[model samples]
Target: MSIKKCRQEFEKIFKKYPDKTQALLPCLYVAQEKCGCLTEEIVSFLAQRLDLPKVEVYSVITFYSMFSFEKKGKFVIRICMSLPCYLRGSREILEAVVEEALCIKPNQSTEAKKFTIEPVSCLGLCDIAPAMMINKKIYGNLTPQKAREIIRRYKQEKDK
Candidate 1:
């Protein structure tokens, strides 16, 4: 993810769409992919590059869960709160994450910035139910004890 690569990608996005507005999402993705998080600096750069209003960029990023305006923890824990997962004890799993273990709440990172808990719409693992994903690795069929144990293991990991 280099600046040169982002410029190239932006050029392609601009060429593909007749309307500059149409290139916003792709340009945002390209910039975010290169910059890690879409901070104010990156957002400004993207706005100027894409010929968009800064507010428009901000609005779009805020609306999309996929975009991040600030840096997240090394490990992002996404707990599914979908109806299926909720019915199967996802609430207990969330409580286990918040009150029982890590004091951090949803969308907040630990002090060390090691883990961030994000309550997401779904993980598409309804069959397993009560599922959570740490980074890209999925954990499912969880009880509170199981959830605590999994968190402990991640906490002990030397190389995140």
Candidate 2:
């Protein structure tokens, strides 16, 4: 669907809430789903639709790391860098994954336009240390080899 269609759907959802302020979260989510990141254009569009000031929308977007103002790759790879994951070799795994998959450092998007690698804090799955989240799916007990395999599968699916 186009971004315009997504915006219309978001406006419809915003109308359901008694207060436009309460619709902020869902609106942002819709924006992300539409554009892959919450761009300034989307924020302004949302502000106009909800009759809210641009500052309010911009503030929320800036405050939330989940909302990216810049473009991201088709696949977002979030590697857990918390204590548990680190102790379990998350660093090495992250390095290998970035080098092999994206050929870029963390917080960088690949030239292929297929993947983006980021070092995330805790994924809240310490029991399953060395975990990584692809898009939104969490994979635990990760190894460098396993990470590569998962990336391959994701690339194949994205290609289809």
Candidate 3:
């Protein structure tokens, strides 16, 4: 979707709030979802639309981990590197499963731009340690093989 189109859709969301400042977070989410990431252009455009200072918009965007400031792949693979997942051998999974299978290390997107591997903090699934999330879906208690299978499925779906 074009930025103009996204801004048009945002107009409806913006209308819900009498105070445009109250619309900041939801407006940012809408922009991020539509534009794939929050670029400088998008941020500036949002500030103008919301009638807020650009610094205010940038500050909010920078504070949230869910909101990406840089371009990311369609599928972002976030492996939990918290204490529980670490104890469950998340390091091994990071190296063996993500790196070897996808040929992309943590914080790197695949050359084909299909996926990005990120090592994040706790994802609240400590009972099922060594958990990882692809987009919003969490897979836990993973073996290297299971991770490989998940990646394969996504790749196949993308291919199709």
lDDT computed for candidate 1: 0.82
TM-scores of the models, in the given order?
A: 0.75, 0.82, 0.82
> Candidate 3: lDDT of 117?
87
Query: lDDT for every model?
Result: 0.82, 0.82, 0.83
Off by over 4 Å in 1: 1-36
Looking at candidate 2, what is the lDDT of residue 141?
A: 89
For residues 13-100, what per-residue lDDT tens digits would candidate 3 score against the true structure? 8889879888889888887777777877777888898889999998898777667876788998888888999998898888865666
Candidate 3 clashes between residue pairs 3 or more apart in a chain or in different chains: none
Model 2 error, position 42 (Å) = 1.6
C-alpha lDDT (0 to 100) for residue 102 of candidate 3? 83
Give stretches of model 3 more than 4 Å off: 19-22
List clashing residue pairs in candidate 2: none
lDDT of 3 at 51: 86
Where is model 2 more than 4 Å wrong at Cα?
1-3, 156-160
Report the lDDT of model 2 for residue 67: 75
The per-residue C-alpha lDDT of model 1 at residue 152 equals: 85
lDDT of 3: 0.83
